[model samples]
Target: MSYVLITGASSGLGKVFAQEYAALGANLILVARSEEKLLTLSAELRDKYNIDVRTLMQDLSLQESAEKVFAFCNREKLTVETLVNNAGFGLSGAFDSMPLEHLEKMIILHNLTLMKLTYLFLPDMKRRNRGSVLNVSSITAFQGIPYNAVYAATKAFILTFSESIREELRHYGIKVCSLCPGLTETAIFDKAGIDPYQTLMPIGPPEPVVRAAINGLEKNKNIIIPGLINKILIHGGRLLPRSLMLKLGIVLGRNKKAFLQNSC
Candidate 1:
């Protein structure tokens, strides 16, 4: 049977996406690093929604992890009708001081893994002539971010890639969407050692953001940016000079750095 497969399905926006899809009566294949959490989420969804829920515990950051996931799904005959590439993390610090390992993992997980999963699932989706792909990017994808350089670039890749494919798949009745959420209430900031409450921007909840994304996808919207403030910032930032935008990003990055230092 066809199912929606979501990466990073253990917590944060990923977990929320799982719930949202389940609520819509969609069967799910939840992939994440934590087996315990994935199993728990699967049980909850299965019990509440009475839909088939499969769990795959794998770290997308590792080499060949995406292939393994594809293999697992194929073995189980779980045809993926919707793919949500939502697994990613940010590292906040000066590019020179940040750990190269973390950057590499971000590159693999945020960019490579998403690409592979999409590629693996695309042919089947084409054959079915019906599918949806939701790529969870960030508002930072609209411009360069100094402290979170690699992370922003990876998300930028997602935004552009999703747009490109959205056009190509339109003729095949496949929906491809890029969800560029601004600051949301998620553990990503905590993992990055940056506090969202200390930031200047308004942080939103994951529910509305994910809701807007799924709704947009249903409407066949290619780019889904949630929240009024974020929509303004993103669209307004495009009108500003590139140099000014970079400068503004630098200032925000510095504030984030100061907060991280204080927390440490």
Candidate 2:
């Protein structure tokens, strides 16, 4: 049977995506560092949805991780019909203050690993003339964020890349989507050492964001921005001068510490 392979499938948005696809009767190949969580989720999905769920414990931050996942899929004869590159994290601080290793790992997880996985699986999808790729970016991708510089930049790459490939794959009936969700209720802030309750902005729920992403992909929407406020923020930034947006970003970074801390 065909499967949907999701990286970072152990928790937060990735876990939600796995559950959403499982409910739709799609077999799943779940990848994450937490083998125990993956196993529990896999069993739950199999029991609840009666669809096959395969778990692969892999740390996607390592540059070679994607190759291992590809090899595993090939050896197991798993035909991946959908690929969700959702394994990513954020570092919230002055860029220089953040550990270089942390920054490098973030870059690898968000950009390099995602790119490599897409490159590896896209060929077979093209050959079969059917597939979907959903990449999780952020509203921050629309402009340069101050405190979240590197993270936003990586997401910008994802946004641009997803759009470019969506057009390339259009004639082949392969869907590629960039899911740009604003602050949602997730443990990302805590993981990044930022307290979400301190932020003033409304925190979105993961369910709606996941639903919107799936619905948008089904409708062939290349860019899926979930909330109205997020859409307004992203588009309004686009309308403003780049200098003005940069100034605003800096101001937010300096003045709105709580919101800035959790926004990315």
Candidate 3:
């Protein structure tokens, strides 16, 4: 049977994607680093939605991850018609303070693996003349986020990459979308060691991001900024002068100094 493949499916927006797909009677392949959480979510989705649910617990930061996941899918005889490359994290300190390893892994997870999966899966979909790939980018992609430098740059890459490929894939009936969401209520803040009570970051819930993505996918929208506020922010960044935008971004968005000083 055909299925939707989603990375980082154990929690937050990934979990929401699973549920949304399950409700539509699509089988799911959930990926994440936490095996126990993956299994739990799989069981729940299967029982609740009566749709097939599969789980892969893996750290996508590793170089071989995409190949390994493709192998697993092949072994299981799974066919992916929809892919949501949603597994990602953020670093909210000064660029110099961020650990080199953490930043590197983040790039691998956020950018490289997504590209690998799209490349691997696109060929099959092209041959069949139907498919969709959703790359989860961010609104921050419009401007440089001082404290979250690497993460923002990676997302900019995702948006550009997705848009370029979407153009090429259209004639083949393969739709590509870059889902650029702003902050969402996820365990991400805690994971990044950033206090949720912080003054600058405002977040909406993950459900809207998930819903908007699926809606855009159905409508064949190329780039989706889920919330109105995010749309405004993205537009605002584009409308303003570059130097002014950069100054605002640095003052309100980055923590390079703190992170650089404390980086391990």
Highest TM-score, which number? 1
Q: What local distance difference test score does each model get?
A: 0.89, 0.88, 0.87
Q: Return the TM-score for each candidate structure.
A: 0.95, 0.94, 0.94
Candidate 1, 192-257: lDDT as tens digits: 888776666788889999899889989989789999988898899999998778766753455755
What is the clash count for each candidate, in the order shown? 0, 0, 6
Give the residue spans of candidate 2 off by over 4 A. Answer: 250-264
- What digit string (tens of lDDT, one per residue) describes model 2 on residues 1-264? 799999999999999999999999999999999999999999999999999999999999998999999999999999999999998886777789989999899989999999999999999999999999999998878888777789889999999999998899999879999999988888787788765555444577899999999999888898999989888877878889997787566433333664454446
> lDDT: which candidate is best?
1
What would the per-residue lDDT of candidate 3 be over residues 1-264, giving only the tens digit for each residue? 798999999988999999999999999999999999999889998999888998988899999899999999999999999999999987887799888999999999999999999999888899999999999998878888777789889999999999999999899999999999877889887798876555354678988889999999999898999888678877877889987776666533554344334333
Ranking by lDDT: 1, 2, 3
Error of 2 at 226 (Å): 0.3
Q: lDDT for model 3, please.
A: 0.87
Which ten-residue region of model 2 has the weakest summed lDDT?
250-259
Error of 1 at 116 (Å): 0.5
- Residue pairs with colliding backbones in model 2 are none
